[model samples]
Target: MAYDEGLAHRLGEALGALPGITAKKMFGGIAFLWNGNMLVGVIGDDLIARVGPEAQADALAQPGARVFDFTGRPMKGWVVVDGAAVSEDSALDDWIGRCREFVEAMPPK
Candidate 1:
């Protein structure tokens, strides 16, 4: 499964100089981790955002967002935002910020 390099580039720029940011290949795409935890990811031009369980419903209500169901089962605390929704830098940043807030609050793995 080939992911979108263009989206990955935009994600990298959006993550500019963020400490503990790392890229890892997963779910047939690239995932960005914050302090060793999964934050956001680029999967075929879409964004996989870990918004946490508490924000799941709200996150799903966002434009172009849906439950992260790469497999048969849906992930309760994650959402996949369509590429169109995050085409703009600001939109991407908003999603990333939401992911950061979730990842940052968790204990070290």
Candidate 2:
């Protein structure tokens, strides 16, 4: 499965600036890795962030956001940002921060 080249490229660039971050395509989307852990990603036009359950509430409180439900049920500690919202650098940074936070806490794989 293919994704938006433009969005993927932009996301890739942002992740690149982040230290210890890497990315790869998976599940038809892109997965950003931090220390070998899945930190954040782009699934189609949606922005998936691994914010963890503790931070999920606050992350979801943002406009144009929802739980990242990969399966039928919503995944705890993760959220999906509306693609349209990612147009701004600030918005994208917010999602990336969540992912970074998770990765920072997790032991490297």
Candidate 3:
């Protein structure tokens, strides 16, 4: 399926408004970089949020969310939520906040 560029643009704008955040294209998707760290991504109709394993349970508890597994195995510390869950600014911000918290803990690239 094709990714929603309009959605990506909207997301990118919000992420970009935050300090030390940038957006880039990769894996046929849009990745949001937080302080030079890969925090989240927009894949097709999904909003990929990086929530460390410690916070994985909380992230999973959110509606329409699941593990983010681009490869065969499900990746730890990351979750992908359905577009419906990201339709609102607050919801998107909540996901972004989780991603930022994890990304901030990582060493700069």
Q: Per-residue lDDT for 3-103 in model 1, tens only?
A: 98898988888886998888999999999888889999988879899999999999999999999989989998999999999888899889988888888
**Model 2 ranges off by over 4 Å:** none
lDDT of 2 by residue, 1-109 (tens): 6666677787788878777777888868988788889888888887888888888889899888997777888999888888898888888887787777766988888
Instruction: Give the runs in model 3 whose Cα sits over 4 Å from its true position.
Output: none
Error of 1 at 24 (Å): 0.5
Task: Evaluate all candidate structures by whole-model CA lDDT and list the values in order.
Answer: 0.90, 0.82, 0.84
Per-residue lDDT value at 43 in model 3: 88
Query: What is the alpha-carbon RMSD of candidate 2 to the true structure?
Result: 1.3
Question: Would you give me the overall lDDT of model 3?
Answer: 0.84
TM-score of each: 0.95, 0.90, 0.89
Question: Which residue pairs in model 1 clash with each other?
Answer: none
**Model 3, TM vs. native:** 0.89
| Top-down TM-score ranking | 1, 2, 3
How good is model 2 by TM-score? 0.90
lDDT of model 3, residue 70: 86
